[model samples]
Target: MIRLFKVKEKQREIAENANGRAPVKKQSAGELRLHKDISELNLPKTTTIAFPNGKDDLMNFEVTIRPDEGYYRGGMFVFTFQVSPVYPHEAPKVKCKTKVYHPNIDLEGSVCLNILREDWKPVLNINTIVYGLHHLFTEPNYEDPLNHEAAAVLRDNPKMFESNVRRAMSGGYVGQTHFTRCTC
Candidate 1:
């Protein structure tokens, strides 16, 4: 019975096609909300978003964050965001693509940002997530750290912590762990 409506809709589409126009694809409720959220995004100067799949495909994209001040200053950090079709109700999946030595960011490129996890609320948007990520580098918390060794150093020895950070950022080893060339 619904196929009858589809046939009629198809006829309408065919008629519309005569005007040199293709039938408009219907967007899902999630797509509509995501569009609204994106349009309202007010990103900071240090952050920018890019769609590697192009503008037409907004569901998968990357964000770059360059901290202006902190131990990670001068570093270019990239993150990938995958928004599900059931967005707004479900938070986007976010992961860091840039590898860095940090208490909050894991080796496998998983980030420990609170907004992406337990702290997330439907009211939160992309802008809020970006800001929260930026805060991670500027003020790394030792209390709830993913890298316990780094956190312990930060908590126990402040001066040694600073020195190790400089060493690691310069593409050297803090102890036995060798870091790659860090531009930060």
Candidate 2:
């Protein structure tokens, strides 16, 4: 196949109209895979994807997940994804954009999903990763917690964990840490 603008440094050039008519850069093997993965994405009812940097830049975007069922019900969680020019072979960089009390997500918005790291494979797509993130909210793992205090409370006193989550979501403090407003 013929190659076009250099994938590594190519920036989408805008046309006269603000309608965003920039040509799609000829993707790399990795980017081609990423495009396919995104095009075939099957997000859940409670999940929505958005491109903060505009549709021209599909390499980076955000996914919002609101689990309809489980302890996380009613709360909104956001995840950011940054795909590399060499994608698919490498999982998109994902981070928690919402501040929530979860064992898998730290206060700094870093996520602890296996599929996003060591367990990632080229076969996985945006759908797979989104589902994996949804699962984390539905069933937070006590075994591997990014928030140790939250984990301990959940393990020792289930009721307390629930209470803390409620408090945090209400734009309150769980302890010394102050959580921003949440829809969950």
Candidate 3:
């Protein structure tokens, strides 16, 4: 059986060489699924997906969100996504690339989203995650938060929270934290 398999592999190698092209690498299940998700993506007009590592590296990508409404409206936020090879079984690691004052996003770009955490299920795809992220900008959740201070302001004084978000998005200071202008 081993000999037969080796012979077949050698034949395939020879055939590939004859074709004068590099042998194509087989796509893993995760890669295949990611490709499907990307192809079928129903992204919002305000959101855009980018492959900074080029189109070849599908496992890593970036998502840019520009909310059309809410306090974050007109502010541009970028998030990085690193999908594992065993995707569906494991949620993608997502991090905000833009520094902004938001209850669900921390200073270090760590996001506090249920779907990305304990609520993550194999059924959820990249499109679902993108919608969830868009939801965060439209309605910044104050209940479960990574930035406790921001959450507190949102919970206790929503007007103040709005001011803070504006300050952060306009390249101003929110407390001691300096934020770059992300508003467009």
Q: Give RMSD to native, each candidate.
A: 2.8, 6.5, 2.7
Write down the TM-score for model 3.
Answer: 0.92
Query: What are the Cα lDDT values of the candidates?
Result: 0.83, 0.84, 0.95
In angstroms, give how far residue 144 of model 3 lies from its true place.
Answer: 0.4
- The deviation in Å at residue 19 for candidate 1 is 2.9
Q: Give the C-alpha lDDT of model 3.
A: 0.95
Poorest 10 consecutive residues of model 1 by lDDT? Answer: 175-184
**lDDT of model 2, residue 134:** 92
lDDT of 1 by residue, 1-184 (tens): 9999999999988898898976677888878877887888888888898989987778889998888888778778899999988887788898888766788877677888888888888888888888888899899888988888888988998778777777777788877888766563
Deviation from native of the Cα of residue 93 in model 2, angstroms: 1.0
Where is model 2 more than 4 Å wrong at Cα?
Answer: 1-24
* Superposed Cα RMSD, model 3: 2.7
lDDT of 2 by residue, 1-184 (tens): 1345554234334333347665545767876777787798888999999999987778899999988887788899888999988777888889898888887899999888899889998888889999999998788888988888888888999898988988888889988888888774
Per-residue lDDT value at 84 in model 3: 92
Off by over 4 Å in 3: 1-12
List of clashing residue pairs for candidate 1: none
> If scored against the real structure, what TM-score would every candidate get?
0.85, 0.85, 0.92
Name the candidate that leads on lDDT.
Answer: 3
Q: Name the candidate, 1 or 2, with the larger lDDT value.
A: 2
Task: Kindly give the number of clashing pairs for every candidate.
Answer: 0, 4, 0
